[model samples]
Target: MQELQQHLEATEQRLDAFLVKLTQRAQELLNGFEQEAVNIRRNDTIYGQAYSRFLAATRGQVQKLREKVKEVEETQIMPVFYRHCTQSSLAGFSSMVYEWRNRCQAKILQWEEQLYASESAAIERAEWQDYETVFQSHLQQYHAEKEKVYCKQCGAKLAINQVYYYTVYITCTFCQTQNIFNPGTSARQLEDTARKLAEQRSRPVLEQQQFYQQRERDLYMQAHELQLSLIHEKNNQIIKEKQQAIARLEEQRQEAVVKAPQLMEEYHRSVFDELNNLLPDLREHHEKFYRAITTHYQ
Candidate 1:
């Protein structure tokens, strides 16, 4: 049992170290992107003439990193996450590594806006706000230029003004399934929104990213707190769970009383399901919306 404890601790450290390595790589990638962003923002240079290509490349980089994060979650995490550990360590998987995933995502969203603004001409013109807003056109012009915002799941046209700048999760009346939206996105991205939604349109996604990040942190925190109680106050229960998990593994290996497997595949599935259950559905639904908005102009 003591050996098992030591092994679990070592596995936890390995998982933690692995997450740090992934983050380091992501940071390195973004550092190169930051330098390119600086170059793109400078309209006086020849590089600025190719801002469109740079922008596409940067977006591609972000997408590539996002996919990598998903791959790690699907592959690397199972080894440690499924093993017998203190409940605290089990919960740590979500708060620690999954939190890193979300933090990177938030950073990417902020950088996306920053990169866009660097070339917006709006940044050079800004004296009033750090966040850029649509300012040049009027509302009537907005209506003429854009299609009505509609529920992607259903064909119902959505009311756009209420959530024009930031993404919102809305339950569609027709489909009764949650849908994500950045309402009036086409108008919001326009240089102006008839001055009515101008302020809303100019609002930076960085501010909105905070809300998403906090929501994720809150879920992990809650799960971590509960797991900590199991570690400290419910140690017996934790031991029983671990023993049962091991016994199942022993049976799977055709061992009655011998040393069992270090981890159960079932435990991994449960931990993964639990960690993802924390916020996966929300993100999955939002992704469809995210794709819609990101590809709107394309």
Candidate 2:
């Protein structure tokens, strides 16, 4: 029993040392990626390509770290405990493993948020701004050119009072002729641009929604961990306590789940509010799209 305790202690120390090394390696990778990202010009054509490569590399490195942790746990850490301890005695070691793995995974998630999320958002915003410039230029030209359209049959000048995304029939006041008016491709494409711009503006609300989503995930993980503990707990009292804890965690998870829809509703309302403001003429279309999205979520 003493030898087994010594083995368990040694194994834990080894895991701790291994985790530190892995963390160091992960930090180095993040530092290198950040340096590379800082050097890449946002306006460069290859900027997106470089970012994609960096993301893939970072994910690969994280995967390797995960595999290393699993390898060490299986080959060095758990085997000794499993061989020397009964099922109930193994529970503590399993919890330790769980904690170490969680820490490693959490570190990876932290690195991803620190190194990627903001940079990705910035890149998206920059790209959107570039598109917005072109879209505004074309919209201006379209509006200026479409102010007056002459009837083909009677050569009477007809006034275009509103922007049309698609083809329309304008009845000439002079000859009562139906003149076909096409807004052209650029004007039609404005619908897509308008939606994109609105979404870009509402990104902050979307991020808030994502935060609630992550909270739900974390609660679920906590509940699952407690369930595992319950499975391994031999003492009736401890098992009952774990079950109660799991119940509380499950309640919290349900509450978190409820918040997701509420937050999503907020995001949807915000997006369409911006959409309606940007293209008041297309409110009907926006409302239809919003209804479809909200219905799907429900």
What would the C-alpha RMSD of candidate 1 be, to one decimal place? 19.2
Leading candidate by lDDT: 2
lDDT of 2 by residue, 56-94 (tens): 766677668767766776687556545544467665566
Those runs of model 2 whose alpha carbons end farther than 4 Å from true positions after fitting are 1-139, 154-156, 235-237
List the global CA lDDT of all models. 0.46, 0.70
Q: lDDT value for candidate 1?
A: 0.46
TM-scores for candidates 1 onward, in order: 0.36, 0.60
Highest-TM-score candidate: 2
Writing each residue's lDDT as its tens digit, candidate 1 over 96-130 gives 43433343444444444444434333323322332
For model 1, state the Cα shift of residue 187 in Å: 12
